[model samples]
Target: CHYCTFVTVPGKLRRAGHGMFLSPDEVLAIAREGAAMGCKEALFTLGDRPEDRWPEAREWLEAEGYDDTLAYVRAMAIRVLEETGLLPHLNPGVMTWTDLQRLKPVAPSMGMMLETTATRLWSEPGGPHHGSPDKEPAVRLRVLEDAGRSNVPFTTGILIGIGESYEERADSLFELRKTARAYHGIQEVIVQNFRAKPDTAMRGMPDAELEELAAAIAVARHILGPSARI
Candidate 1:
């Protein structure tokens, strides 16, 4: 549930050591939240959004003078990856296989995944992803399969509670599993219940019920247990 949000640079802007200075308190907060939820592993990621202005976000980063900090984080991430040691989950959102291949020399063992679970934007009549749902899955699978071919062992997750249905969740898992098999190595599956964070578009929207979460996990476990690690 602590996945990073990369709505700013294309792929490499707010990763580990970038201007993003996470405090000990922040790390502890993440660890506590993850442990409280019975999670065996904690997650972390870099933020990248190539399409937006990010006036406020940029100002904050500039104030922090992240040049040196980012360099250090990059080195640390590389160490973790190269050693194949799990340091939470490393998320590089909406990235291509070519880009991921470049990442392999750094953190081979750390978990990597595509951030395909963001909420849909319906406000803009003709937005970037207006009709993206149909084609995005295939594009995502192509990349996942590539990760498999390299033996990088990765996983896929989703954004639930954003008006997605029981059937949709089941279908998404089924499709991800199918895609993962084609790729070769999948470690685990994660499901995040949608929470309407304050100031977000769907802030006032209701989240999914407990029954929905339980049902989804049960279904996924049943469906993915035989072959891949779920």
Candidate 2:
């Protein structure tokens, strides 16, 4: 996305710097280390389907005998649960019902950031999420609903001050409340503040003030009621 701040290593940056995927053994070793340190959750945060965009990613997946990045994630999650003291918490983006079903048993909980429900963000080429299909409000919302339908505990929330209005923020919270009421599968709502980062498209933008986040939290609590955690 245009507002993203993830660091990228170009193909020529280092020797054979196309990219690399961690092995299942490597994953298990890290999980073991975390377990030894008394960490309760192994949070797996990854880009969705890098194989679709990079030839090197595709080649690596094929050579590794995995169909896709998500498949590898599931495998690693299973390994972590079976071999370590940590519960695997996945943040793989935009999962379908089948994806949720396949991951539920191995992954106790997973997350996808609702970000914002404002359709306007996807309408302009310069918008933060204009090029990110998974960031679309409808697609993200469907993942939340599917997680509910599939009985997978989910974590979702909005990123304040990303060009969305207060009305849109309220709308997004209402949508989350609707999903939580329908299936009782949502476990957490993160009221995150967006900070400007250098080299990002939104670097020049102002950081989200604490007051805005407080407003959102208050609205979230009011909409989701006392039972929901803000």
Candidate 3:
């Protein structure tokens, strides 16, 4: 069984409605409901360090009595584990060594999409990750390394149809495999195809064809070897 959780706050908190943010009590209640429904894992999906991006985000965290988003998440994870019996899996995006160390004990596992290893897209006008500071490929790789150093079970993968060449997709998978082999922390690799959404930067972009997706998955399997889970 699977369940999910989101901080619900956008990077710019002012851009979101008041109802978007969920209180700690609300999170616990949802966890209890998930436990009753036989859900065994909870995924914490939220903005990556929104407090650093917007003043309103910082204000909200302060108002909630949390010094930072990671602290708040750690507390929620512990609460969910103690009260609801669901293992917490976090997707907090790019993190530092300290962040990984702090989260490792509370979250049994964690993840972040490698998306792509291509840095060229970041410079393209109106590219999917153009303005996102945390989307830097090198930064994301560092997070993976730090997670490995912390001995955390990790999940990571490449994103297709994001203006990356087939070669770049293979590069991303190879990079992930190298890190996984070195650290032994990567437990799963996901091959995700990008779907353009409305009112976003890549809305007009085309989705990956089935053939392309299959090829990418094959590359992942080949690079990650038989011992890896895909």
TM-score: which candidate is best? 2
Q: How far off is residue 216 in model 3, in Å?
A: 1.0
Worst 10 residues of 3 by lDDT: 1-10
For 1-230, candidate 2 gives per-residue lDDT tens digits of: 77776535436424764346767777888999999988999999877777778787788889988988888898888888888968999997888888888888888899998988999888788888898887889999999999999888888888899889999999999999999999999999988888999888889999999998888899989999999877
Return the lDDT, model 1, position 227: 57
Please list the residue runs of candidate 3 whose C-alpha ends up more than 4 Å from where it truly belongs after superposition.
Answer: 1-20
* Predicted candidate 3 versus true structure: per-residue lDDT over 52-92, tens digit per residue: 86677787789889999899999999999998899999987
Candidate 2 wrongly placed segments (more than 4 Å): 7-19
lDDT of 1 by residue, 1-230 (tens): 22123233423445544533454355556566656676655455654321224554445545655333333334555443333333445564445566566656654333433334223432233422344342255565566677778777686665566554566567777767776667667776777676656644445667777887787777877877775555
> What local lDDT does model 1 show for residue 89?
50
lDDT of each: 0.53, 0.86, 0.82
Best-to-worst ranking by lDDT:
2, 3, 1
Cα deviation in Å at residue 47, candidate 3?
Answer: 1.0
Clashing residue pairs for model 3 = none
TM-score for every candidate vs. truth? 0.61, 0.93, 0.91
| Cα lDDT for residue 164, candidate 1 | 49
